[model samples]
Target: MKAENLAKILKNYTSGWVSISKNYKKVIASGRTLRVLLQKLEKMGNPDGYLMRAAKDYSGYVGV
Candidate 1:
């Protein structure tokens, strides 16, 4: 997916799991935990797409 599009879709999410469309053009679902997210997906007939995490604020996050 393009960085520009990804940033826009993820802007509202500070922390949680997000289900994005396969073409990366839309948000299918989101949840504070994986389990909740999966349950939501199941209810949606488990649409084909990608599962991702919207992490905590990274403005001050340090990673290796």
Candidate 2:
């Protein structure tokens, strides 16, 4: 996935609450708030893809 595409997904959310697939093609996780979004990511392992959004909103995914 391209950084540009990830940016596009993030724009939709002003807050840091979204997770995209490794290819940045699909949204694997998303939340209206940062906390919820993070919980989702935590449940998931470090996916091949990457995450985008404000640093304050996301700190990266944690593994189970």
Q: Which digits, one per residue and each the tens of the lDDT, describe model 2 over residues 1-64?
A: 2223344555556665567775556777777676777777788874555554533332353322
Whole-model lDDT, model 2: 0.58
In model 2, which residue pairs have backbone atoms overlapping below 3 Å? Answer: 22-49
Best by lDDT: 1
Per-residue lDDT of model 1, residues 1-64, tens digit only: 2333466676788888989897777889999998999999999999998887786554543322
CA-lDDT, candidates in order = 0.78, 0.58
State, as a TM-score between 0 and 1, how close model 1 is to the true structure: 0.77
What lDDT does candidate 1 reach at residue 10? 69
- Which segments of model 1 are wrong by more than 4 Å? 1-4, 56-64
- Candidate 1's C-alpha lDDT? 0.78
